[model samples]
Target: MGNICPETYPDPFNFNPDRFIKDGKINPEVTNPEAVFGFGRRICPGEYIAVDTLYVLISSVLAVFDVSVPKDANGNPDIKPSFSIGLICHPDPPKCSITPRSDRHKELVQNLLNSDPTNE
Candidate 1:
């Protein structure tokens, strides 16, 4: 009983996160993916914090970097993506490019690194 069911999520295998959005806001009618944290009284107590942290982390990364499929030697996108099945499902790392979105973003990252005491 995963959230990947076709009845609940159309074309669930495809990475269409925009399905959860409608009119510039999260669509309440869409099934929430919180089932991964369990259900009812047995639900993980840290779920809120975990989800919030993930939102912040992902937003931060997207703000600073441009992530996309990597180009092959011939300059065509190498877009093969697959996942491993288990208790915790996760995508197998695909060939992708992650670069700072701009010179300002790169400088911001450098400034962050320079300010970290542990980096010394």
Candidate 2:
């Protein structure tokens, strides 16, 4: 995993999906980041479902919300995205501003929350 990342991917820490696209197409030359799923016999069994779940979750969030870095009192963004290295590397509680994009989006989220079975 270390070999494929920070080397094959330029500025690996940043989320730059454009590396996979060139000339309005998915560049075949660049290595797919999904290699983290493992390769050959060590491949994960739940890779397909995991990828699908991520797609659904990401798309759903993007569809209803506008995500950005929270601005300071001076109207300057206070974004300092840092990662913590551990058993599993993850962002160190980066601040984000997620707001419903529109009234319809707000309603959609509210309806989903209201209809949630676990909330009963």
Ten residues in sequence with the least summed lDDT for candidate 2? 1-10
Q: What is the lDDT of candidate 1?
A: 0.89
Find the 10 residues in a row with the least total lDDT in model 1. Answer: 75-84
| lDDT scores of the candidates, listed in order | 0.89, 0.84
lDDT at position 83, candidate 1: 87
**43-110 in candidate 1: lDDT tens per residue?**
89999899899999999999999998877899876666688999878989777779999999999999
Candidate 2 lDDT by residue in tens digits, 36-86? 788899899999999999999999999999999878899987666788888
What are the models' TM-scores? 0.78, 0.77
What is the lDDT, from 0 to 100, of the residue 106 in candidate 1?
100
TM-score of 2: 0.77
**Which residue ranges in model 1 land beyond 4 Å of their true spot?**
71-80
